[model samples]
Target: MPVESIHGRGATRNATPTRFNLQERMAEGDWLDQVEALDGVSSRRTSVTIEKPKSILTRNSSPDIGFDRSINAYRGCEHGCIYCFARPTHAYHDLSPGVDFESRLFVKPDAAKLLHSALSRPGYECAPIAMGTNTDPYQPIEETWQVTRSVIEVLLETRHPFTITTKSNRVLRELDLLVPAAKLGIASVAISVTSLDPKISRTMEPRAPSGRKRIEAIRLLNEAGVPCHVAIAPVVPQITDHELEHIVEAAVEAKAAGAFYLPVRLPHEVAPLFRAWLDEHFPDRAAKVMATIQSLRGGRDNDPNFFSRMRGQGPWADLLRTRFEKAVKRYGLRQTRFPLRRDLFTPPEGAQMRLF
Candidate 1:
């Protein structure tokens, strides 16, 4: 049977088995099967499950990534972006990395409390905490859950430095908290705009804010004295690659502090899911798109090396870098990194005192 694209959803199907081989297949009467049956008839409604984790802060020592620690208030994004690199994480829960990764969501209600506890530890070091690294902190469900907002509240109370990366304009809703934090040189935001065209954005990102809205968000954030940058992440080869110059120009017009981009990456189960998305939405150029991506990824679905993973190696990668550098220079947009201050960090009240 041909994989039918679900309405208002990015994944064409949800039965893509996880890479862990935890289960052979879905049971006959599983709710996922019911979802598959209602594909064309009705849209799949988003379902949120509350999660209480012991610790809210995640520490990573990857040399490529700038941040040393991060926090994810939610797992499994609802934005439904087909190229999301975080999709494979759903496999840990025995969930599909496809539609289930988007519709069946998880929110950490105790994130703020746990974060407060972590910051109060005597050995805790001050560093920028990155939000929306694994899942968007501002995904639609945030309106009700307010978990991300709660997490921010803790960060603000402790006077800790942090950064947020999201594609939704909803980050504007937190300007009340962000403004004061920015004044302290402890808060910054990066808005990801994958494509400028509404049609492409609708099918590609599905639930993310429109490109125009995101651009406006950049303007608003900068005007509010909060530093904002534009991120053209996962720039699709044949589909959205043509908009690189235009996107940079838009970022300049919006007064973005800086802009950066990365090529689409397909690792683990994401490879098959992305391929299915390409066939459903861009069948004509699917093969060409994969070909270009392989060339950028060194003839593989993905490059897992440290530096090379972040910065592709082949000629195509070089060309992308060259074009991006020229565009930033021509548009007069600074590509310089924005440094967040750690000196201003103050541990939460009741924190254990350190003795030299």
Candidate 2:
């Protein structure tokens, strides 16, 4: 079957008022002042459509990122985190990076096969393959598609090294595979926990596993002997920044081996999307939030300049770094600078190892 068939093709649109507009998936209706009027349409659950990806592995060579290559089992994420940097990726598929990014999802059933072929090639190099860097591999559709599981299966079978980053506790479902990989020093997991507040998490990352659940997942993974860490990432300045220490303390309590933190980044189309979300959710504090963000981002929406982008510049950035350092020191969180061994990698049958 063609890749398009494996990933569900675009649906034929019908002029039905009840049907959701997939193209504008994130557009929220007017705040309904009355409750009774929402009864007719509020109960309907949207049907998921699958889309097959032609290939899975995506490569990048940047000084800041640790991994050189990564794979995403799905195109758009259903997690619908308003602060997701990967949100803008949906625009490439002719969808809005906002609502369409969260609702009009795509799954690549062929991910395992494509990864196998890629790794089976003569030119293939052994590097930690990062998942969930762009989209959550274990999002809701994972229950049905199982593409992430299959991909992990391929990695485990070949004794391949990989790392996963995700916001879902669903990754616990694959501990059977990951635990073994960890034993071989071929795998590690990072759970992205944005905040401990349930109310904040509900609006910020609507469809992702709750923050508490993710912390529980970290504890579970660590108990199972899979190296796990908490990624206190994309720290929204005035919003979730205050919770940094709280997040680290919780992660350490949950037995996370180490912790890392990064400031909120709004590159490309993510800038506008983030602004819109801030406007919608925290209208009262939107300006203050953006102002704080600009304080770190060199007085702009984002800093796209290499080293500066990841860490940011100026006093606010320095303050955050200092705060993070102090928190990690107090919490005794482990360091993720744990390097994976690449010498054990062997080329697939009949393929020569890459010289590079």
Candidate 3:
């Protein structure tokens, strides 16, 4: 049986259903049908329709996070990182936080324009507008949609401070804009490098670029005078922890100005998804990994408490911290945060309003 795609409805038959009611229901939008059918029973290949959202700035005040506002050009990432904390966000849109989270992606075509409008609004504050805090802004679709690039242009023109977090070298494509922004102290970038091992990276981040490429991205950004940082984030215990020092060393070699790390967070549906991935990839070591994770999570899959969530708890967590401190010192990685300037911010030039 050639299952073309995963149907959102109850069992979708690829071999033409015998039931007329099923076909009618599918046609009526009661279910989703992939537009393209592949020969193999792989993940669904559906046409991605664009949704022009009304607004783009997402404000937050979580003590665990650094930024006050963030923007995501796309909902649901193609990277398919099993440990993504953003997975639960898809559920708010009435979509499954699992397979649907990766397959059914939405692009905000109006993101750049909306961001510009938001920033230009009177009384708008000039805090760093975080990008890729949810789904990556430089994901594969960026090549076609160009929403992230346009948003960068808007930020650059207005001298707005912004920070980007991505695992793709595709960001290098926007160096022309980034270089100018960096010179003005209006921009910085952090590359998320999970594991140095390609095999582990493939399973951990599925469709994301290779770990080596991300290192190269950091180097390129630094060379262009853009402040580059390496985020050894969601550090999976027992699995990727050992590579923390190695990753930091590599980042140092690549000329990353600063470095940061976060213990793996398995909030919401991520816990089970991570477990499943572990079982599939490292069954023998699955128990040990979960045990260590639970220890960090205070005997739970996750600890939602403010500060503790960013960094974890227990002996393993302390060890990771010590390791990070040692590596940063050893590699001469800066502990100082990349502080974006607020004084440089200028409202978009236009005669649109004069209420101020």
Identify the leading candidate in terms of lDDT. 1
Q: What are the lDDT figures for the candidates, one per model? A: 0.87, 0.78, 0.81
**lDDT (10s digit) by residue, model 3, range 241-309:** 989999999999999989999999988767776787788778999999999999998999999999999
State the lDDT of candidate 2 residue by residue for 276-333, as single tens digits.
6777678999999999889889999988889888888899899988988899888898
Q: Which candidate's TM-score is highest?
A: 1
Model 3 stretches astray by more than 4 angstroms: 2-43, 351-356
What lDDT is obtained when candidate 2 is compared to the true structure?
0.78
True-vs-predicted CA distance for residue 154, candidate 1, Å: 1.1
Q: Give the lowest summed-lDDT range of ten residues in model 3.
A: 9-18
- lDDT for model 1: 0.87
The sequence of per-residue lDDT tens digits that candidate 1 reaches over residues 1-356 is 32233678888778746467686655222465466756543446677888888898898999999998999988998899998999889888888888889987998898887888888888988988999888999999999988888888888877889999999999999999999999999999999989999999999999999999999999999999999999989788889989999999999999998999988888888889899998998999999999999999999989888888887889989989999999999999987376888888878776422310
lDDT of 3 at 168: 92
Query: Which pairs clash in model 1?
Result: none
